[model samples]
Target: MNKWPVFCLALSAFLVPTAGAAGQDVQAGQILYDKWCAGCHGFDGAGDGYAADYMLPRPRDFTLGIYQIRTTSNGSLPTDEDLVHVIDKGMPGTAMPGWEAKFSSSQINDVAAYIKTFSPFFEREGAPDPLEFGRQPRREGIAEGREFFEQIECFKCHGDAGRGDGPSAPTLQDDLDFPIRAADLTENWNFNGGGSVEDIYRRLRTGMDGSPMPSFSDLIDAQFMTEEQLWHVAQYVHSLSPEEGPTISDVIVARRFEGDLPASPNDSLWNQAEAFYIPMVGQIIADERWFAPSVDGLWVSAAHNDEQLALLIVWHDPSESPDPKWLEWQQSVAASMFPLLDSVGVTPLPDRLTVQFPTSIPTGRDRPYFLMGDARNPVYLWQWSSQGDVVPEATATGLGNVQPRRGESRTLASSAVWHQGEWRLQFGRSLATPDSEAELQFATGELIPIAFYAWDGSNGEQGSQRAVSSWYGIHLEQPTPPSVYLSPVIAMALTVGLGLLVVWRAQRREEG
Candidate 1:
């Protein structure tokens, strides 16, 4: 008789308290849920609240007894602790907000108990035991893990480089028949469950319920792979993301270089320049507000010589828009976000990026409106679209007011590449343009205001429906003076001379 099953049963009993537990009051939970959750989850817990239509992934229908985040086995009820954890920390990459600061532990517990009452399955089956997760073994390198990754066909949804642009990525839908996107493995910070290796291991073992992610526990049971081998896969997945999320900065400094700027985005010279991470949010202050935006943020690197300036912008995008493969994805996103509108004639628009600057540099803290500009103060723009290699120069006084500048003033040159779910673009221009009034002149030692707007056309973004960033600054770094480098050598020489003089003086005094 194996004692492991008995041990697990014993542990499960201790992990979850009974429904009739002392701290859990269903009536008290109802009051809290009605006050806090009713707006999105509905009074009947059917996920049809007023705000439900406006959100993607929608709200959880508690009556269905299905959850995406869980510690238990797939197709089983999430443990009470799982519910409490979600309620306290909330789900990332969704509309859910953490309630740890707002609700007491007991209050959260009461709500969790109350949520179970919506489904009859909970009453009949009770809470399920969490899966046994063994200790992680010593890493055997990502090579073996990469092999396992391919064997399991993770690339079918997560892509070869884990940017979520795989062949099946555009077609994925949740169990509820709502369009869904696969996780971008390179951005673990946005993982709904958590980003740690242990969290990844658990997700692999138990799988995410109410989603296409399925458990691999059967592989272990069938002796195809051992528990230790699965941990390697988790470690490999964990290695895909950065050690920490990118930090936001107020300014991007352009490094001074000796020669011409990097010829293309792939130039190794660009690596010498530090990359700045800029976060973006949907344009919501004006009409036709965008609630969901595909492009979340971008990485920027800048460099300049005496005559010219260059910028390399890198961002993750699942698809190169206008690609026939993503046509269905474009339609699905449009229909889901705007069900009342007709999407029959809709065609995929090209992806675009715009670099924004005030037509005239701001003299003070005051600047034009972030959404393009106001009539009184127009803004200059370097607009790059996927449809063409040319980067057109434009000016805008407001959201809809844009004038493209043609002929001699259009000196902006650009190169772009989309590979493995990422876009790398390099834009080059002269430091000083012929038409200073209509264009931005890059100068050293000055803080030039900068902003960005991105359009992921596959997500139905166009016109005012795009991702935008608040005003930031770019400073062209001044060249290092030769005197500053010589100062260190001068100090060392003086120190040695002073020590020699002191030794001589001491020897002369001893001789006397």
Candidate 2:
């Protein structure tokens, strides 16, 4: 697991020199912006272009100028270099594309100045000095940084391991009081602040606006540490990037809750349950991993009440669908106009996730293979499709016996929400399904064999091309109060003690 420094919301404000962008031509920038940016950002920069509505994170409404990412404090505007950097590299995991290849450095600098024109905030900017980054990264600095990380309690929100599953993760909120998740330090690609060492340092120094990541500048009063210590901590954070897959246990039992159950994927209550990440490697059947996957693994947690069972599955994706549905028409037009593009792939992707279980709980230790199952054994597959709004259950006797479920069943329902670059899918079903052989049932304590398959529509994964997993047992783990089992043990002990006493008396009497 990667260790992420707490999200930093840095000091109140700072000044930065225009430096390289000074005296750039705004008119030239406007022309470039119109050619490259107006299609999505709108001519007025209000983020209301024809393409903006279809964008996952709608194009930035520059008029508001409330940038989510910045080196400046919460309310301050980003520096010119900040804007130029974003344009040059492009924001990864978003619809934005880098202009560095298409435009010269001078053109990019001019466009950077033009982007500021949409918002008057930059006009009032007073010159501020760029933040001072002390010494270069060194091994000696890392040790000192570790001390600062612990001293400031960065472990509380980012977790001791920096996996972002800290004790306070579920309850973390932004300045707007909206529930916000801490950054999963391992997935460097999704870092909105950028992932370079300098980027990490800037994120730590400036902090993310509205997030729990507070800047340590003020916190680091000389008594606490020096400026170099802050840089060392940033380097330390960079080093903590997740090197391997998360720890996955062979057996995972569901935590049980009483009365009401969590309905949404983001519910804070779900955090109480034991989280086991089922990585693609752990779950994917060896013979079948045909294509390279866009994702490495998935996050999973399960909970059960008296009647309902909920499974929350989370995985990362760059696009919600295989490609933007909104752009399909345009893509077709371009393809038709250009015959040379005949070989260009236009995928028909159906994003979906499937869960498989033995049609009936397996007997003894024998269980079916994790795939669709063999002809000798059958499995029930409950499928959730991104295209379909409903949760339909299917039963497959083997790889070819895929059939729709018939008749009313005990339970099946699901809900999902997509946020940031991750999709949180929640599925619910009943503990028992009419006590029938055709349905898969769950008992309070007994283990049930379960397997998962996920399809990334955007990646053109379909049929067997999808990611698969080995079988993992799922069981409801009801909480046991200390005395529930303790009293029985105590009684048994006393009963054994009395019997021993009687035996000893008889032996003694006989000897006498």
Candidate 3:
């Protein structure tokens, strides 16, 4: 029997509306909302729609008139323009999708106008003008900005390096008591409103409503900080993120080096290697499916000498696995996602990562199954866990069928470090091994298939419940031959000689 109807009804009752809304006669907007928004925001705009329970930081209850992206001060209504802006741009890092391409300007305005009718607050207290945000000042340096960041205690929630692993991050909840994670300030591209300096300044002044963030207007009124000083804080936050997000590439190129490979992730030699970004998604193809994955992506860099190969993997994580401080956070997430299941007395587990390769290089397009291979074609694996220093080599016929390759096959070595809110791991191995039957041998200029699997133990990710990636290729670049360089020099010398001979012949002909 289909249980969707029963499940939605029970969930809707659990999430009762906080306020009542009157019927509005905006026929056009009502038609659009029913078709696009009702599935998540509910028919009455109470945010009890069928899909609400499955989402974290659940859908916004429009009847309350509380919004997160706004230019107005806290506890105030947003302008009509603000509403239209959110509708057009949508909320990033969430399920909401931008409708600018799908809807016309008039349609968007009509929808924004209709949304206001859901809450009586718009009638009772009208939206005030947006706050004044002056232009950026020519400050001496980011030194003052850094000072302001510490003075305001931004580190209490955003962490020392703005990676969002502060002590208070684990206990934060939204206005509706749903668990919420602090923004990882280092990733400005994920910011809901925008990532520009002006955008950061506006968010700082107004703050995000219906969330733990608070407005700083009182500080200005009380002489705690001048407006320009607040701008410095914005500048400091803006500096945390890179100029642009990393670009995705289909292949990772391993550069050949003359000297030994980098011994650790922090080695300066790694600076010369190119980093490749790979995006990850929750592994939902198998049983015990995971819909939420803490690790979003990874940055990989590879280098090889004649005898050895080294790979550096970097990723951001809010907490070191099994940390006592984040234990409550683990329980809170479990309770929110699976309220009926008993999550008490559950302990955090170690973080894990698996690097997969085919047991033998494929001569054609045919390769082993992506899910750790099938019975017919097995896979070779280098598995690492945060609990130990050794990286074990293994073979797997399929998921949950991994077997550690003891004896001479266990040749993988690794080093790892977790600081602030980031983890850096380096894996090193020989280019060729005696156990070629079970191990993949590296060759220059060959496109080797590779894939990745990661488990964030703090987020209850393990075994099949983890983040995964599809197949990608890695190529070991061959060193340039000496003859190639000599050819270019020889061509230049020949050209010069030919030009001199032609000039001498022309002079001789004129003299005769």
Candidate 4:
């Protein structure tokens, strides 16, 4: 037999059921399952509900019996209590509705019992071996236990060393990205609901809703584990230290940029300048005629290698002039040297400012490049390099002409022209009403999207009768280096320790 499998089987024999599991109610549980859950989870416990296909993550396929999320020991079955809890709490942002008030406590308990019947591994026995079953007790002699932490996906978010600083930390923001913190497995105290082994098991079994965690109940249904596997994985996760901190690289500083536009006449010549500001504002727009005057615009800040910045402008004029003013305004504005404003988070490095309105331009090294207007209009071309030299104008994508309805919105697409090192791009949008909004991706290339916000009127401004008046800019670039944390370290240590033990044991056997 494989030494690893033998060791696991030997270590878990102790989890065999006591008299408590031999008694009452497997059939009673079945009756309840048919009444309450058969509609979605199927009579056979396979997730094949009429509505299951429509769900994004897909409904639980209990027939496979592999639970994706739970607080129980890895490979071991979830306790009866674990099943009961999820039915009551209800999953957030999903079709799973809570049964806390809908079903009585007894009904919920019955349903929990019924769920276990679908998975052959679901045991109503004594808890698995805490060392081999619960969290691999961070015991001194159990070398393989530590190694098990990394084999599973524990270190992906929770740092390798049991800290919570995994590589995906920055993207897990508070607002846009669910403020998810990989469990600091080593800290013990930071455990969300509770620090006990069962508590952790529950999280794994049910999977936290609204977060990346997924329920693992179906994993058990798949016959992936025979009781022993579940217990071992859970024990490994539990053994990790929870108090791990982040390394310097994991530290991040959020920043913004600003600038001002020079005053211009209200004529068709200002179309370039006015078009440049379309993405800046949410409402209002320049009439169709180019060169027809009056434009509303503002200046925005400059950026460093790893920062994100954007400008928003909203125009509401509907009058059509034979001589368009928006295009002219866009050209005049993008050509200005002072277009790049102050720093939003980092200090501005000294570099020449090249303004290119509508033409596509070549970017030099990695310093920074600017995406001016729409690619079609070749109004102005410019570049800013570290040596403080203004490179002559190049082909540029001029500003786009966007005329949305009273409650409509439109987006402008432009290339992230390469500058010094990384590429840069810009987008313009016009919102005709307060409730109007638009989202545009700079390009579908290898880029990290940055979220931006801007407002033209009061907090609750209403353009009920007026055109949409709001705009947003999405910044794209490769993600910056990530900060290090302890979770990964602990997980790595555990995995390496297990592998070494396996090798060492083999050598000892040969010597014997």
Judging by TM-score against the true structure, name the best candidate.
1
Where is the poorest 10-residue window by lDDT in model 1? 494-503
Worst 10 residues of 2 by lDDT: 7-16
What is the alpha-carbon lDDT of model 3 when measured against the actual structure?
A: 0.80
- True-vs-predicted CA distance for residue 95, candidate 1, Å: 1.7
Q: Model 4 compared with the native: what TM-score? A: 0.31
Tell me model 4's lDDT, rounded to 2 decimals.
Answer: 0.37
lDDT of each: 0.83, 0.66, 0.80, 0.37
Q: What residue runs in model 2 are displaced by over 4 Å at the alpha carbon?
A: 1-185, 188-245, 282-289, 325-348, 389-391, 479-512
lDDT tens digits by residue: candidate 3, 1-512: 99999999889756643232322235567678888888889999999887776566678899999988888998889988898898999887676778899998877876776788789998799789988887888773467879988888888888999888888988888988877888889889878888888888888899899998777777888999988888888888899999997776667778789988898989999998998987777675666666677887889899998689899998888889977777777787777666777654288777888889999778755567778888999999988899873337889998898878878546689888989889889999989999888899998766777888888888777788788877777777677675654444344333333322332344356324
lDDT, candidate 1, at 83: 92
Worst 10 residues of 3 by lDDT: 494-503
Q: Candidate 1: lDDT over CA atoms?
A: 0.83
Backbone clashes (count) for model 2: 16
Across residues 215-290, which tens digit of lDDT does each residue of candidate 4 receive? 5555666875433455455556666633332221111121211232212222222233312222221222322211
Better of 1 and 3 by TM-score: 1
